[model samples]
Target: MMKLREIAHSRTGDKGNISNISVIAYKQEDYETIKKSVTPEKVKAYFSGIVKGRIIVYQLPNLWALNIVMYEALGGGVTRSLSLDTHGKSLSSLLMDMEIEEEENEAN
Candidate 1:
């Protein structure tokens, strides 16, 4: 087993009360592993405490990435939130902590 960070890197962005997290695999071959492990349901459950709305996962096969959009995630819009990480920039790192089963087929 290994953290998702081992195979991928992420970026986070926010608009209104929503957050978008992009997970891009380091190698094209790892895209399948990411797709299998990082689902909308899983992400929503992972951020259940912080996010109050739905999670959407979009596949970007061309870039070997997944774009996860979380709605109503921020306490409020960035300007109105009291949380230290209002913009959710660090959310990616938080997500990178997610554990995934490493398969023999996974790219190095």
Candidate 2:
């Protein structure tokens, strides 16, 4: 097992109560591993407490990235919410902490 952060980096953006996080693998070869582990269902489950609505995962094979769009996930919009991480800037780091089973190679 390994933390997602070990293989990928992320950036986050927000609009209203939605947060969009992009997870980019450090190596192109790692993209497939990330794609297998970082599904919308998995992400939603990982952030279940904070994500009250739907989660959407968009694949960006060209960039070796995955964009996870979480709807109604901010507790409320930044302007209306009193949460410390209003814009959810800290969410990216939080997401990177998710653990996943590392793929085994046949060569092993």
Candidate 1 C-alpha lDDT tens digits along 1-108: 899999999999999999999999999989999999999989988898999988989999999999999998988979998889989889999999999988684355
Which ten contiguous residues of candidate 2 have the minimum total lDDT? 73-82
Q: Which structure among the candidates has the greatest TM-score? A: 2
TM-score of each: 0.94, 0.97
Can you write out model 2's per-residue Cα lDDT over 44-69, one digit (the tens) per residue?
88998999999999999999999999
Q: Score residue 39 of candidate 2 by CA lDDT.
A: 94
lDDT at position 9, candidate 1: 97
Clashing pairs in 2: none
- What is the number of residue pairs that collide in model 1? 0
Report each candidate's C-alpha RMSD, comma-separated, in the order given: 2.2, 0.8
